[model samples]
Target: MRTRRRFLIAALAAGTAFALAGCETLNTVTGLLGNQLNFTQPQLQRYLNHSFPREFDKLGGLVSATLTNPRLSIPSGDNRLRLDFDIGVSALGARDVSRGHFALASRLRYNPATQGLHLDNPEILAVDVPGAGSLLSGGTRELVNTVLVEYARNEPVYRIDSDVLNRLPSGKRIGATDIEDGRVVVRLQ
Candidate 1:
């Protein structure tokens, strides 16, 4: 009886640990802006298929319009959309902000009758600003906000509310220019 009790306790502990470890794998937008965005293969695939392209058209277009030679490309995939683009900020006279890369994993949705496109849960996995060096932090929020606002105006399907933006760490007004990197990241999700 004593041996059986000990074995049951050991098994319960092991099982608890395994369950907790699995929970850690769930990824959220908060994780990405914090540079902690991690997703399982299936989660990543779902994000790519449902949310990527619309995000690309909205945010990606802003980045493209604001910068120079902003190349956007979507590669074909079985389940989701994969895109890689490069933009130079020099055209805006902010040479320091001119060079960056944006990568997106997302999926596409369409309404046959309306011929409309919808993207869901698209994640901006990486944004690399090589030229601005540290200054990238200064304008990252402005850039992100600009994209978000543009998204709101152009894409009715994207449900970004001012309340959600206000819930972000900065707590600054949605259009406020004081925003920095961490604030921008927190709102990205």
Candidate 2:
């Protein structure tokens, strides 16, 4: 009886260790980068590596953008803008693709001549990767390009109230916002 109890304890300990080892694999280095904006190039690369193909199908094209003026203000500032847009996908792969419904809040620098707010950087405002295994499979570059083009065309056009916005340099917002609708159409090569 005594030996059985000791064996049971040892087995439990071994199982715990194995479980921990498996968890380590899922510890994507991306997590260490955190959701802060102002990411290092490598950090940004990692985010784009995982994010683009996962969200979009094609690699190039202008995604449309719509700007919404703010009705209220946070302590950050009043020159905030809300952006809404979508990127087109040629093939969403066997897995499910999330309906593109993401928003990014940006601190805009207005160009008086252009009458537009410029995105200072590529900090992700929000993302909606619906579920696991939902990836664009034709090729990684193709998938990434699709999302990037959409992102480039639909750049945010408003300054965000930093107080409500997650200050993390790479923070990705998960909820929906009020902004005009836009679309990205992808063409196959």
Candidate 3:
């Protein structure tokens, strides 16, 4: 009986050690795959701005809204960008065809694992709609950002080249991000 108990305890200890070693190996693998990365402003604009119309369309569809003509711009001397778009909001099951010009101001963020850029703290900076006036002006700003943007939770606003993204995994991490003079500078690793 004594010998059997000793064997059981030894087996349990060995199993625990193996599990810890597996975790350590996983960490090492992550470290090997990670890297430091950088993205220029022009590079960002080429990809981000060009793709805005399609991506914004997806974002609007999440809340049953229609977004068109998304234009991305970085204001001079500001650490944020404005996403100007035409939005058609439909509510009340009947789907009213409300359309207007709108702008969203957002700060930028990054995720190392995916090597993707994210727009954070999006706010409606401007809105123009005929006849409706200010009634729908401020009400849907927060809701559009928080509820309609389902892609933001898991997806990056934009991703780097796959080769670069794979290199900058979570193991090393994103170091810094700076937006200046119509450029986005990102430091990774």
Best by TM-score: 3
lDDT of 3: 0.59
Tell me the TM-score of each prediction against the true structure. Answer: 0.33, 0.29, 0.58
Better of 1 and 2 by TM-score: 1
Model 3 per-residue lDDT tens digits across residues 143-186 = 45643355455556567656544555556555666666665556
lDDT of 2: 0.35
**Candidates arranged by TM-score, highest first:** 3, 1, 2
Rank the models by lDDT, top first.
3, 1, 2
Which portions of model 3 show Cα errors greater than 4 Å? Answer: 1-42, 45-63, 93-95, 131-138, 147-151, 167-172
- Candidate achieving the largest lDDT: 3
Error of 2 at 180 (Å): 22
lDDT of 2 by residue, 1-189 (tens): 999999999999999999875553223223324532121222222323333322332334222112222121121332333343343233323433334444544433333343323443334455443431134444333343344455445533332224423332344442222112121111111
Per-candidate clashes, comma-separated: 10, 15, 3
Error at 38, model 2, angstroms: 27
| Cα-based RMSD of candidate 3 | 15.4
What are the lDDT scores of the predictions, listed in order?
A: 0.41, 0.35, 0.59
TM-score computed on alpha carbons, candidate 2: 0.29
